[model samples]
Target: MPGDGPRRGDAFEHDIQVGALRPAFEAAGLELVEIDWRAPLDDFEGLSLVLLGTAWDYQDHPREFVTRLEELGERGIIVCNPPPVVRWNAEKRYLRELERRGVAIVPTVWLDDAGHGDVAAAMNQFGTDRVVVKRQVGAGGLRQHSFSRDAMPDQDWRMGRPCMVQPFLPSVVEEGEYTFLFIDGEFSHGVLKRAAQGEYRIQSLYGGYETDFTPSAEDLAGAKAVVAALPFDDLLYCRIDMARLHSGELAVMEAEAIEPYLYPEQGPGLGERLAKAIVARL
Candidate 1:
């Protein structure tokens, strides 16, 4: 698994992934090694597969990251989900592709940069008083902002980066966001991520917590649709995160095929499923 070695910022999540996946890979007769992604690519010469793991800092050096993956692929190393998939998923704009494929997504207004004027315009477009502005290429809720009509930003305030604006979904705090982990095009498990009080981001780093969740048939179908809409069919793993729309239907928040943490704590079989899928790819 390609990782950031020991100094990775998200140690807790890294441990969870390694603890669960290492043994499973062993039992499946595969030798799993964790290596720093930034380590010389030559270090991976004898490795057969490069499963993108907790290289969470790749967002800061996206170009370098993609080049590394491409180099690995050129060396005949099997890059699960492949380089093209990674390239497409590195930016959040891929959400637009899913929406174009007829999948429901949280209404979004794509912008080169977001200022107070853009925020107000978005609120009017969505008919919502509150809106969220998020970086076009970000994860873990970093650099995201929430503003209500009454709490508009100053004229000079700006996101100053490519961004997307969406109406704040009340169901995020009222119910919670749901994540469905799909292994090799099949549903493996579900998790409901609930943010702590006064927070709206459902990332564990922000004091969010997860619980085992069994999706309703309709909701599960909705998540399945997201997986189906993906352009590639050979993805070894996919994470579909959804939130309820005001109409009581689930809408796509993210179709993560990158290095998403497959909540093994919530789905005990995640390790085994991933290992088996890896083997199948070989």
Candidate 2:
């Protein structure tokens, strides 16, 4: 597993995902080593498998990250979630692909060399005055920002960098983000994460917190449909993030097929379940 960001206290300090998996993996007669994806390594030879852990820094060097994963794959070391899947999902543009597949997604507009009029166009397209801007290939809320259509600045970021513009979903701050975890394509657990007061980002790094959530039948059905709409089967792990719309419908915010944080602590026996999933695949 790959780890990055501020490391203080114990090595597994705030890493519940790794902390939970370690014991279960060892119990299954396997050794687990957590490695930072950004660290220099000659090769991935000698490894049974490489799980893409919280490689939060990958957005800074996506090509290098994919190259490393490819190296591991060519060396016969299985990369969970698979390298091809990572390549496809690493970019936010996959949301557009999902929309094309009939999965409900937040209305979005892809932009490159955007001008002042493009902002208004996005607002008009989504029928909303506020919009969220995000990089095409980013994670952990890298460079994600919200701006009023009329208040957006003429910045150089919109010139060459690729980004997507979407109407700001107020439900994120009102209802919260719902996440469903699937191990080996089987549902494992679901959690609700709320942003900090007056904030929109729901990651803990942004002071958000997780809590228990009971999804409606519609929620489950909608999420299931989205999962089935994906092109692959037999994924090692996946996290589907949904938002409750004003009309009480669930819209996919993201289908994390890569290094999504699986909050094992939120569900009983989830770590063991994940371990079983991995062992079964091996």
TM-score of each predicted structure versus truth: 0.96, 0.91
Model 2 CA lDDT for position 267: 70
| Candidate 2 backbone clash number | 0
In model 1, the Cα lDDT at residue 67 comes to 90
Model 2's lDDT to the true fold?
0.79
List of clashing residue pairs for candidate 1: none
Which candidate should be chosen as best, given lDDT against the real structure? Answer: 1
Lowest summed lDDT window (length 10), candidate 1: 1-10
Error of 1 at 107 (Å): 0.1
- The TM-score leader among the candidates is 1
How accurate locally, in lDDT, is each candidate? 0.90, 0.79
How many clashes in candidate 1?
0
Model 2 misplacement above 4 A: 1-14, 40-43, 155-159
lDDT of 1 by residue, 1-282 (tens): 234245534468878988999989999999998887888988998998999887787777788988999999999999977889988998889999999999999999999999999999999999999999999888888779999989998999989889999999999998999999999999999999999999999887788889999999999999999999999998999899999998999999998888898889999998899999998888
Superposition TM-score, candidate 2 onto the true structure: 0.91
Instruction: Give lDDT tens digits, candidate 2, residues 201-270.
Output: 9987677888987677778888887788777885888899998766778899889998888877677677
